[model samples]
Target: MNKYNDYAKKMNCLYAELPEYLTWHKDSKEWEPRKKQEVIGRIFNCHPSDGEKFYLKLLLMHIRKPTSFKDLRTIKGKYFDTFREAAQYLGLMETDSTAEMCIEEAATYLMPAALRQLFATILVYCSPKNPKQLWLKFENFLSQDFEHKKTLNQYAIKHKVLDIIAYHLDSMGKKLQDFFFVDDDIVTRTHDNLFKEIQTERDIIIPTEDLLAIKQLNEEQKVAYDQILHHVNNNIPNAFFIDGPGGTGKTFLYRALLATIYSAGHIALATATSGVAASLLPGGRTSHSRFKIPIGENNSKPCSISKQSALAQLIKSTKLIIWDEATMAKRDIIEKFDEMLRDIMSSNIIFGGKIIVFGGDFRQTLHVILKGTKDDIIDSSIVMSPLWQHLHKLKLKQNMRASLDPHFSSYLLKIGDGIEYTNDKDEIQIPPQANVPFIDDNTTLNTLIDMVFPNINDENLDFSLFVNRAILTTRNDFVHEINDVLINRFPGEETTYFSCDENTYTCTIPDQEELFHSLTPQGLPPHKLTLKLNAPIILLRNINPNEGLCNGTRLLCKGFTPNIIYAEISVGVHAKKTVFTPRITLEAPHDNFSSIPFKRKQFPIRLCYAMTINKAQDQTLDFLGVYLKKLVFSHGQLYVALSRARSIEQLKVLIRPSTPLIQSTDYTKNVVYQEILKATDTH
Candidate 1:
């Protein structure tokens, strides 16, 4: 270790202690070739937004002197012209055409290919204290190489030679007893020559293979997608919102659109609200991360793209941008991106001349704050805020999961009511249905464990738990309570408690936490995380808090503040000679009864078992049971529950109404009836 440390210290002295131009500034001091970068702070003083003059000046310094005007003209006309043409051919044009055209013949002849060496020399001389000695050393060094003439092409081809030469020179051990050092002014003059040669190539060409793949589209998809494509082909800016529920081939359609545009020789970009959502679309990244927009600090400033940055060019050239999970994106974030696009395109207008297709459900909005006046849905929560209403909205009402149960899907969504279910062929097991057990008894608990345990035994269970109410208390003391129960009884049960009352709100146990950490520790990843859970215990919102109802709901568990609790229920069982009861009511204990506000509805208490109605919310439970208690349908609750299930056969209802569960509500019936009518009218 000592020997290794000695060697490292020696190397650091050799390279780090070199009296090169890089040592001029502190940031340049750490330039270790491969790992460190020479700090080239954005030269804000230059005009034309491109460093053409800066690059040209650096190039001129390398040649030092010219023998004749014709020689200078040959160097300028042949070399400079060739390089400039190449840059132009590659679409490296920046915002400054006049500045780029300032390349004169005399200057070109005087500069030659000395940009790299000049950079190195200037970097070394930037250090005020060591400037003079470095200058004398550089002068002596240059005298030896003055007779040699290096062309731009040769310098480019032998870039490593300069690096190696500098490395070797810096490696030489000092043997002098005393030597007179040069002055800082001389050091500055000598430093000017350091960047004479182009040490490293600046830009590289990336193959468009990965980008091309995103543009492949099927004929069917292209037919449905051509409207936007045609607009882009005509160089018109357009925005589109493709809203559909969880499934309906939104992602597939996006891919087809991308492929069609790219195949037509157009560039395409993709973004999303969060990283997890972004992953749903091809070439995914969160909007903020993709655009590199600084949040909070400078909300007004948009991310800009310089032509010098290759990635900026790539984004600028892209003809289409597909943003998935659009609902989760805030108007400010979109606005910031729009600002960046306009800046890059050099236009005062919006959207950077690119066609953007947004895909997301407005109902699934993750943004807690409202952004603009457009596309604003005036829910009480966002009534006071400015709303950026989205234009060009397209509704995808067709439910692919409807194949699981078309009528029940419609009914569940309409009334916020859930249906009863028996078993899931997907898991080869039965899951608990609805918040209230079919019979409102302890027998439901037994039935649930019996049906669910066998399927759980067949495979390694890994899934997310979604519960509405606590079986025990109203306060969030359930983290340890729930953890202890599962650990003590089930032993190896993996669980995550989504406690709204708790400060952290939600934390997954082991697997889900690991997955979340891997994907999105900052917040929601760019893509939605979909994983299977086993023995997933959920606390349902069955009891009233005033009546000691624990505030538990799927939204709460999934991380939402419960704004209101509509009703309360109380049910329980006392087993003989046991500290713990075999069954507990999903209802809140009637202790804090005075806190709840007045309401017209009557609440019933039950075991708070997973009810069949929650199937509409897209969860698959694995315990079969029936609700024997008389069920009163809330305006929207029942519909949300029933629609969560994959299929209707999974539910088993004992006391369900003779007609559909939601036969009464005007809104429920309207949506269900309207969609059917639309289908009929289309047919």
Candidate 2:
């Protein structure tokens, strides 16, 4: 059995000896044992046995209570005092001079084997100089070393240590800050300070020269712009939805609106569903970051923002809130924001009587709930929200992306609208130029790769070429495979980083270890990740927004330090700039697995020669290769993959060959929920 289980069993044995302390409850008509704290405190109060005092001290150290610093210090001192007493009483620390030696002696003799090992590991890995850094390093070490042991996981270690520290602090009535230099509360405050700093430093200076460069808006765009501008200018309460397909100048219109609003010295908060989309806007932020939207949906609780908060002040003074790529967000999020605005601004009208504009194509992917059914998805979509009906719809028709190639633009529109030509079997035919015919051999894969990533061995290839070309895939497995193959082709010495994986739970139950080992969800980084010089990688976590190392930011591997990976920014506003990315712990959500309730920690970087279409959403690429090893499963997957490329020549598709080849090719299935389209059409 694991050390935790052994310790728990020992504790339970001690609990079994408390018959005299049992209270008879008249309501329940049963004898109930006293609370754990009362029991531990009572035992400690008495001139207890060495074992009893040691266990009590340990238990008290793990209990969490909110108290003052003096009390916390007293509790901490009590724990060490008990440890020293226990060691002396047991004749284990007769000559041990150091506190660490005393602790080791006391823990070895009095604590359970599992806890003994844990304490040893903590001491070996951590130091007092940088407690937080030490704790983090210790946790990483545990994850890597004890991953197979089933006694330690990231969550378990974090909670276990924090609880021990918190309990002692609580007993002394002190905060964790008194003991450890780092704590969650401190980190949260730091982030809040950073947010305020960003807000204050963020200059929304739209260059007058750039605004002058913008030509006249088309007829469709003109109508939408005029209406939005009028509403903002007159202080009219309005909620508008700008419905446009990819490359229809929604961004163009958005910029114009932002420029006009900024020029007039009015606040126009530009936000998007994604980081990439948000970056396209003038002083834009992701809606979640800007509004402090909770990670999970909770209808009962509003946003964490209070009326006195700086964010609240910003919202109050804001003239317009333009949420780009709105269709990607869940309806509940929109409703929650609405509720928060109403609560904050004290208005019953939609979005607290503010002019909020949401823009995105309904034809694109909606709210993506993992493993959710089609019905679940549609229900969660923003179009299904009650507030959607209140939205004034504005459509942008002329395709700005394909304005030079009108025929190609028409073809794209047909595909997106699901009006593309199909045979009797309902299979769409691939255009001759766009389709890379599948030759019935392994060379087909090689041919496709050569065409997509040409001059792979060229030493002097510009970094822009890497940014321009990407292979899009339906599955993460294919993405990994293609990335591996492509990275190998790149001329450089490779550096492979192996992730430390561990079961976060110390399971006493049978077969739990086996179960955890089998669980590998999507979005979790692999055990072994390889990188080479000039190879591209995508950031899985938001490292630093100021340096443009946010999630979805792409970087090309340039060099490496002993502890950090140096890379040049390959995408976003900080493109071509070199940045240092450190090895940081990242935890994939537990909910994505079988409700296992354990986070998998790993480095937050992934190879990016190819990427899943879901990750590629809202990103526009110059050259895209759609390699379909399997059929596109989710809604708008095919459309999203195809629409990533700017023009026809820039895109290439390679489908798996059919045994009985015919005139019609097996194209990607287009899943458009007709009811949603109908609802939007009527609006």
Candidate 3:
């Protein structure tokens, strides 16, 4: 009888029919069971050797050394395909790389060396001549060591080989999960040998039963998920631009594909543009980390990993890769990442030349460096790159945002033109009594506290009450002048501010060191502070900066209260030298503005909802206040503001008879009208 069979049978009898298997053997160290011996005898009769010769043959089969990437790939193939044909071919092939890979793969899958040694020592006691006698010796050894906790009982036959392994070794640990083959504890050669023992080509052999048991999804998600799954299974290598409007179930599809590949015994990797987004998914890391992609490395330099490195191993073992917020990836970033993978894998490829998926909306661009269009992928570093292609694309059109401002919110994107507001949809509760009194001139505007906050208990109003004035003016002022007003309003309150422009604003603070210390441990920068401000003022910086900041010698600002105080004046420079200058230039186009308050400071300007045409673009407001003079509104300017509102009631065109709302000889005007017509048709 083979040693493993004897062991397996003895364990089976112990668990199922111990009493029936009991027997007395005086010469033995402990008592034995007759049934246990009989089962061991049956196992011997069923098969011959202890599988030692097969294992040894498998170990000695390969000859090639594994250092190059090609060698690693070859070994990876044989490691995964454990069957007669594959094993025989690998055994006959004399490749050092193949042998090394086999050793590595086996070690990864099998138990540690310490446990193997204990199993081998116990094997010495088992003999075919006195099966019952041997059984007695084993039982006694186990009983005596029960106090020492060195004995084990569990055993199972592996499905592919039907070969026995110590499934439950008491000496190894209470559970398999508790054991790990970490780097420090390993003896390099012994580790290599142990790996060789377990090395065999073993493809994933999922039974029909397990697959049948998986939970499924609703019809729509199922179809979409299946399409992606099929593409992955085929290993279709290409960029996939999946555009779904915000709140569509696009993320759900990504999760489904990941789960499938994982269930099939393959690893999956996930990444995204932001750490916050990465945190939302299981096993997600930043794309920069995954690709070893350095920030601002926009050119030919590429990151590469050795074929035998742990990172490369992890990637090779993974079957699927998912990238979210893909729209933020610039052309250069994607190309550099692809270049690195190709070098590591030794193949010109797309999707790292494996199963890869991407999810994002192109309209939300965050990549500032890449200039190439979506279709162009040129690799100057390589004579040839993978042919430009896309694998599969899915578009999601559903809108899921704050429901209270559905129509208004929807119009912010061109796609939202079709959205209709429904009472049944989600709603944002704005208290009906929250509306506040309005004013025109500086004094009345200064009394505009209720607009920011409705009641005494409303904390939003506290800032307005604490500040000195809310001056209303149509003339643009230089930033320094604005800072002056802010410093005058709040003499000593510390403040926070930022700009969402291409280049972030920098400020030099007098208390830079103190501010740095105060913000540390919280990870905020020294000059950046946090403050709360009213929505309109916030919107001015965030959305309507194109309207204009006051013209003057622009200088850094600080020390503010109620979130709008500006301080720290510097000699504003023009052409890098001329400073403290007052000359202003309106070089850029301006957003429509409400007319200067008529009748001086007599009454609050009538419901001014002024916005720049750029900020106004794609917006459909409940009401719009467009102020115009003699120059005709460009087709570009007119359409940008008009589209913001859903209908005419939402639009209030405040134009004089001579304002020239329409004019001839403007080709761009025709184009704007056609686009509006198209938008209307879609709805």
lDDT of each: 0.35, 0.65, 0.34
Which structure among the candidates has the greatest lDDT? 2
* TM-scores vs. true structure, each candidate: 0.38, 0.70, 0.35
Native-to-model Cα distance after best TM-score fit, residue 550 in candidate 1, in Å? 32
- Misplaced by over 4 Å in model 3 are 1-221, 233-239, 262-265, 297-300, 369-388, 400-410, 415-524, 528-683
Q: Of the pair 1 and 2, which is ahead by TM-score?
A: 2
lDDT of 1 by residue, 1-683 (tens): 11234333344322212332122346755433223444432221222224565323222222223333233234323534433332332222221221112212112223222322322322322212343344333332332233254434543333333443242222121101111243344333433433221111111112254345345434433444676767777878777667555445566677666556545555666666544344334444456555666654465676644544544666666677887865445556676677777777777655666677877643332343324332242222111213234335555666655676676556444332122332231111122343323332345433434343323333343322213212221112222222333333332423221110101213432212212222211111111111122222222221111111222222211110111111111211110101100011122222233222111111111112233232223233333333323342222223333333445555443332234543321121101112221321232
Error of 1 at 199 (Å): 24
Better of 2 and 3 by TM-score: 2
RMSD of candidate 1 to the truth, in angstroms, is 28.3
What order do candidates take by lDDT, descending? 2, 1, 3
**Predicted structure 1: lDDT:** 0.35
Error of 3 at 659 (Å): 16
Give me the displacement of residue 285 in model 1, in angstroms.
1.7
Per-residue alpha-carbon lDDT of candidate 2 for residues 1-683, written as tens digits (9 for 90 to 100): 11234334334433323333444479997655555535422233322245645434433332223133233224323433544443333222222223233233333222232232333322322223444544444443323334456697766655555544332232222335554546666434433442342344245668665476345677888888889888888999999999988889898888888888777777778888877777667677778767877765453465787788656787888889999999889888899999989988999999999999899987777777867998898888887888988999888888876657788778777776777887666666666788887765356677778888898878787755777578998888788788888888888776665443344556543323223434545766665567888788888764444345456778888764323466677765557766544334345465745544444333468888898888888888878898877777766777788889888888888887444554334464555676667778764
